[model samples]
Target: MPPKSKADGAKKARVPAKRKLAEEFPPGEVLTDNAKKKWKLGSAVGQGGFGLLYLDSSGSVGADAPYVIKVEPSDNGPLFSELKFYMRAAKPSLIGAWMNSRKIDYLGVPKYWGSGFHEKGGKRYRFMVMDRFGVDLQKKFEENGKKFPRKLVLQLGLRLLNILEYIHDHEYVHADIKASNLLLSYTNPNQVYLVDYGLAYRYSPEGVPKEYKEDPKRCHDGTIEFTSIDAHKGVAPSRRGDLEIMGYCMIQWLCGRLPWEDKLQDPLYVRDSKLRCRDNIDELLKSCFPSENLPEEMKKFMQEVKALEYTDKPNYAKLRGILLQGLKTIGATDDRKLDFGVSANDTGPPSIKVRATFSRTLKRRGRTLLASHNAVCIWKVPPGSWPMPAEGYLPTAVIVCNYRANLFNSAGSGW
Candidate 1:
């Protein structure tokens, strides 16, 4: 994946081309002469509410591959936010370190190729080219009869936890974590990737502690069914929020539906259900899995996460180890192969592209990193209100308030 040559600044003009933010491009349009000649646009591979993804001329929608062109209305959208994130924090260099340190060649993230503006029908749009991914876990869950095997569910949790650690270490929280956002690498089923960072927020500035305050407008910031309690209160994202969201994801993956899945329209109802279930998840587990006890390790992991303050740094290794041990206890190997047990008829590679589009507008989401004067400031949620700790529990909030994170630095040092 190639890096974007130009650096983005506050109020900087859109690069490679600039157009009104509301422009959109349809099929058969060529964004650039260079793009037209090299990476021709194929069919409209996938379409979401505000944007449409097209397969590169050489790429196919249902084929196993590693690249696509994502387009959004130029001015303000998640795709633009994602472009900045990849260009800065989630750069190849950051992922490279994880790959080398973990003795794995790939970090569960898409390879960013480049980004620029495109035009069609006299309107300009923002576009990014990056690795194409195969079927998302949501579709996989639906096809596999909704419920993920316990082994696969545990392994997925472990894998996503490590990815969350890297993103959180870089000072960002993936506000939205769901089955649709988790994808199997098109080229390698053994590797999974976390995509879409539009809802992600910078919790701290490298090392400075951003005070805890909730923003009313930003409340219920993610998918209602799996959003964190902090988000439900309209606060900014933190590492804990990411983990809490993942906890819900893990439960839904194994159980097929969350206890509050049917109550998405009422965020309060969903939030309260999540709160109750978090305390007595064993009963929930018994009902869902029928044969398994509450995964004590998972319960402990969520408990510790809930105890952290808004500005606290998560114990990534400890949290990861909890999930890893769960896998070990189940006698499952971390071969990176998703353990959904391929049946005789399921021998071929999956033949669908996994992309999700949300209806929420970026305009409604408030200040984007693209428009902010200070890269990492503002947007937050309250802490010390999680319904965790039923009785005798102590809180240890770890705050490192004297460091800096270069969020979009191309160099990728301490991202």
Candidate 2:
């Protein structure tokens, strides 16, 4: 065999290094943006894959700081990707103009306040400033035992439609839309915001849309359980794909699980399952809500999503109408109130199977269930009380409780 050429070596180059975690910045540390605006950092409250989220404010940073700063290494890719979308489409004035033109009370999109590079300890970091948010929908979903009430689901669908249409019109598609990425307003829990634009794609450039094409290397490029068929096929994210993903989210939120969730490790299997669900929406509903009457509006919503083509624009008003009709059918109005309390709806909480691992761990710990609701248990633990799980006893289930998470230690004890 001939020796490999230099080009072959280049083609086989190593993948890029994972982004470095950001170091903590002390409270009162100040950073300036490109606009010459200074933001003071409060305590670090959260962290993401490549960065730390610090409470921030123009005045003295405090416990009630209304803004957050997401800081990552200057050379990292995720922050840069998100910055592009924010700089282009998430400016406050632009979002305000859209909401005014549409006559909507509010939009779910987060406004981009400011962003710039910061240097500390001889390291450069990239950061963006935005409004602080309350707990994410995923946490709320779990607290409610993985199922949102039917009315709440419809309300969420309507809000997401509004958000999707706004981003789509701005030429971007958020490839990943899951409960974890939808966050409530810090001051108003009723208002939700669609966040984490790291995977946002500019489907169209300067009013020109991209043609449909797929690459094997890009296959299964999003959250496997809820990703769209286009994402499974490696096609670039588009408006229809976002809607399709939203459909999946609504189904999961209402039904507690998707048919293919048990096999999420197999992306191709998951893809084929979604494809089959798209072809036969009834079967999908039946599998999800086995004993219950199928939600007619959900069926209609999925059917509408199925009809969309790769390059076609989505009928946002039609989708919103479907959800609005669903609200009407249930005798609920779009009051814009998001209730996260335990649901007492006719559809009882979906059956939950406690994993064998969790059961075994509980048995080993000699713990008895104190109370149970919707398959989640509640317990009381003293403050700062928690114990390390024995090796090889990983559990997948989370307990539903009313207490705030930070009240306990790092690992949850009382649940």
Candidate 3:
């Protein structure tokens, strides 16, 4: 028999010991960073697995605050994991230097502002300051009937290629890539930022790349739908893995769904589906885009991802070229504008938000049925048929769960 999942037991899965929920801090609470920079907090804007996010600004924190501060218990691991990547590679100077050298208009990576520790009521918390962002692409994706326009998808692919190349060059691999993790610029909707590095792994320490190795304990270490094949096999994330994940993101963004989305509760099943798709890229495309002309560029992109070895450095320029060519074929250019409007080719109207559900087993009418994982659809079940979070939940239309961090961050960034 297959191994029993966390939802198999009569009781719900217990929250891990180290996953401590953060206490909210009142507005105007002052925090002093190690650099002696004092940041005054606004109201708590968001919360994640083990952290609370507050608004901050040079003057008074308000709705227009330019920065957000993510605070977690000093003992939490997710924030610490993210801070290392930010400090090492996401510094504004580092990103600026790279942009200048590459001559690109802008990269999608988020800029790290500042980070330090704070003490409140004898409890220590870790905090990092970062630029505030606008709405996440996932929200936009849902609004557009769960599918992005073909041109927008290509533009996003090119932009993410720029981001993956930069982080890979810096020796870190962002193990997780999905719509929810991508947020638009607070001031410029055309500029998107990839955020939430809680699963970032330093595949290279110093200049040496880590050899390919799989650990069973590390299996399924990211968002199930978009995680790379390497991640499913328990392998440590690498450069190729980031590109693979990006490819999956683009496919889902354009096509609206994946073959294994309905089986996300079973990681093994999802992994197997991806393995089959990897062996036959054309079939995967045909299944997703049955009637429409196949996205030749997407097929080529998947082939490239399949050809990559565990340690091989991908030719990002070539991948970007493929997506650029795709845009051209569609009579579009990289105009740097993101259009979230409904596509003329969309099969149906956008899904109306009736009720959202989470991944868990529901005892309905004395029969156990597995609720779908992380989906936003018209829930057909009766009222009270679904489970709820212990502390209640937000009215988010869609929720993408991160397996590695067990985070519920929808405001688009820190966890």
Candidate 4:
């Protein structure tokens, strides 16, 4: 037998115990080297094993977006893990060509600011400065009655897929893709960001792919309901696993929950439930999408994802086409708006909400080129939208059509 690979060792990589955040840095503490003054901590906004995320007391850091400081003990938490990802994928120079090629201002990843060491009462701690984001999707989901608008679901899906493609191209896989890890811009609610790289791992290292073997001991490495089958088997995450997790997220977002969420404690059981669902998508979705049955297009998409191998480069365009097509079928627009709230009365033929039934088709298909092809189509006013030029309606549809669609253009600078 060939030398046993140490993939098993990944199973033993337990997170280090988190140190106390409050004990490390009290509110109003200013961290400085005097030689080059850094961040001053404000009130704590959030906490993680990495430490506390606080508003920047140093006015210098908050120019456009609010800057926040993260303080952590050098020995524990995800700050270091975050640092590695930023070093690789966030560097402007490193990703410049990649961004130019795609025509994206930024990869839906978090922005990295300055980082340094801070000492509080003889204890040394590391600190990083980064953009402060608004409420996360988990919070939004709960506030929206655990379900999001259909239009919102598709918009968020493509945004997330873009992030996945960018990260995957860079050799990393965000093993943990969940609501809580996604944040919105305080300045622009339309922009979605992927956060928390603590669980991210590179599927391919230095052009070599990790073997596809599973380790029973390493099963369940990500969120229970959303964890991929490979994760449940303790195998490293790959492109397929990322899409699998995203599929679960989309189902949960549209339906308000996944079939396996109730069994979160037993991750293995949840994983098994997901496997059962995948094996019988028709039945599972019959219960989940009862009105007209689940979108057949999505089922085919899942099949493609399930078919990918550990080393196979995902058919990025085909996978994205599935989502784009689904979005269009739902009458989703290129508009970045969540499409929530009660409809405003328009002079146009009363808003015709064309809800597609199983037999009636609203087909969609497209190129997955994020920068080149304008594949995302916003869910707009239905066919009944025939403005009589009566009410205060703009004659030009461009203004109201896809607000900020230009932001996704290939010629745009970072937004």
Best of the candidates, TM-score? 2
Task: Tell me the tens digit of each residue's lDDT in model 4 across 252-276.
Answer: 7777767766666676677788888
- By TM-score, the better pick of 1 and 3 is 3
Structural similarity to truth (TM-score) of each candidate: 0.70, 0.80, 0.79, 0.75
Q: Which runs of model 3 end up more than 4 angstroms from their true locations?
A: 1-15, 344-415
Ranking of all predicted structures according to lDDT, beginning with the best and ending with the worst: 2, 3, 4, 1
User: Candidate 3 at residue 176, lDDT?
Assistant: 78
Q: For each candidate, C-alpha RMSD in Å?
A: 20.6, 11.3, 14.2, 13.0
lDDT of 1 by residue, 1-415 (tens): 1111112111211233343333334445555423453455656677644677877644333343345787777675557677767776776777888778878666676666667776667666777777778888878888877767667777788788778877777777787788888899877787788998766677777677677787776666667777788877777777888888898788776656666665566767866777777667665555554342356666777777778878788887788788778777656657676767522111111122222222232222343222212122211112443444444333321111123211221111111
lDDT of each: 0.62, 0.79, 0.78, 0.66
Candidate 1, run of 10 with poorest lDDT: 1-10
Candidate 2: Cα lDDT at 369: 36
Off by over 4 Å in 2: 1-15, 342-415
Poorly placed runs, candidate 4 (over 4 Å): 1-13, 17-37, 57-65, 291-293, 342-415
lDDT of 2 at 102: 97
Supply candidate 1's per-residue lDDT for 105: 64
Worst 10 residues of 3 by lDDT: 4-13
lDDT of 3 by residue, 1-415 (tens): 1221223321111234446788999999988877888999998888866799989975788889999999999988878889999999999999999999999879999889888999989999999999999999988988876898888888888888889989999999998788888999999999998998887889989989999998787677677777888877888899888988898888888888988888778889989999999999998988787434578998999999899999898999899899889887867788888877643323222322433445454444555433455533321222343443344343232222332212122222111
List ranges where model 1 is wrong by over 4 Å: 1-38, 57-65, 279-292, 342-415
What's the lDDT of the predicted structure labeled candidate 1?
0.62
